[model samples]
Target: MAPGGPELLLIVGIAVLLFGAQKIPALARSIGESAGQFKKGQAQVEQELEEIKPDASGAGSAGAGTDAETDLES
Candidate 1:
């Protein structure tokens, strides 16, 4: 009566056998910390984007003003 993937059940059985139930809580806490760190990094990147000032031309397009003739003549 396996409801989901067999791989997950197999891994869980192995973990319970090797580490027992006592160590699982500590392992889960460590995983939670890793997940929190990932989320914090994602938030910092989004905050940096919001803090950035848009260019004066207002289109927010880089390499917009370069002219081929001016560049070639120089």
Candidate 2:
């Protein structure tokens, strides 16, 4: 079951008590920066995958050439 208002309030209160108001902003900023870095890394990986995809197609054509050479040798 989902938390109701009181439960949500209690959780927030606990967070404030543990971290204090002054620290919360810094914590949030760090989390935002981390998330941004994660997104940047994910985009880099996607771009690399796109680049490799063309090489994969080229490899298939190269394999076909090898087969042709084998047939000529036979």
Candidate 3:
């Protein structure tokens, strides 16, 4: 009834009883590591997108079409 589910609360209570005061720092360290990894991955993805961005002169065509094709004999 606490919104997370009875099984989750039971597990959390068991963990607290077992670890007491010694596990809080370790859990926080693990959460920090996860957050740092997520941010690093997000930054790398954004950098890659910026690198592939096209210019305003239309020279960065990504295989859509070429303007010189209309004058060819084909």
Candidate 4:
């Protein structure tokens, strides 16, 4: 679950007290940039998984269990 409004305000107030008003903006900006980078990396990994999904899900996979299937047949 996410934090409530009061909790959020309290966190922000604590941050302001700890970092001061001027530094808060810079800190927030850096946090946003880091989150964006994280999202981009996540998207790239998801894309790679999608690209590999078809290969694993029946595409060119028929031959993969050929030996196992033959062993079972015997």
lDDT of each: 0.81, 0.94, 0.76, 0.93
Hey, what RMSD does candidate 3 come out at? Answer: 6.0
How many residue pairs collide in each prediction? 0, 0, 0, 0
Candidate 3 residue runs with Cα over 4 Å from true position? 1-19, 55-74
Q: List the residue pairs that clash in candidate 2.
A: none
Residue 14, model 4: lDDT of 96
For each candidate in turn, the TM-score is 0.56, 0.65, 0.49, 0.71
Superposition error at 32 for model 1 (Å): 1.1
Question: Who wins the TM-score comparison?
Answer: 4
The candidate with the higher lDDT, 2 or 3, is 2
lDDT of 2 by residue, 19-42 (tens): 998998898899999999999999
Please give the TM-score that candidate 2 achieves against the real structure. 0.65
Query: Model 2 residue 5 lDDT?
Result: 100
C-alpha positional error of residue 38 in candidate 3 after TM-score superposition, expressed in Å: 0.5
Can you write out model 3's per-residue Cα lDDT over 1-74, one digit (the tens) per residue?
55468888888788788878689679879999999999999999998877766553356463335545654646
Higher-ranked by TM-score: 2 or 4: 4
Q: Estimate candidate 4's RMSD in Å.
A: 4.5
Q: Name the top lDDT candidate.
A: 2
Model 3 TM-score (2 dp):
0.49
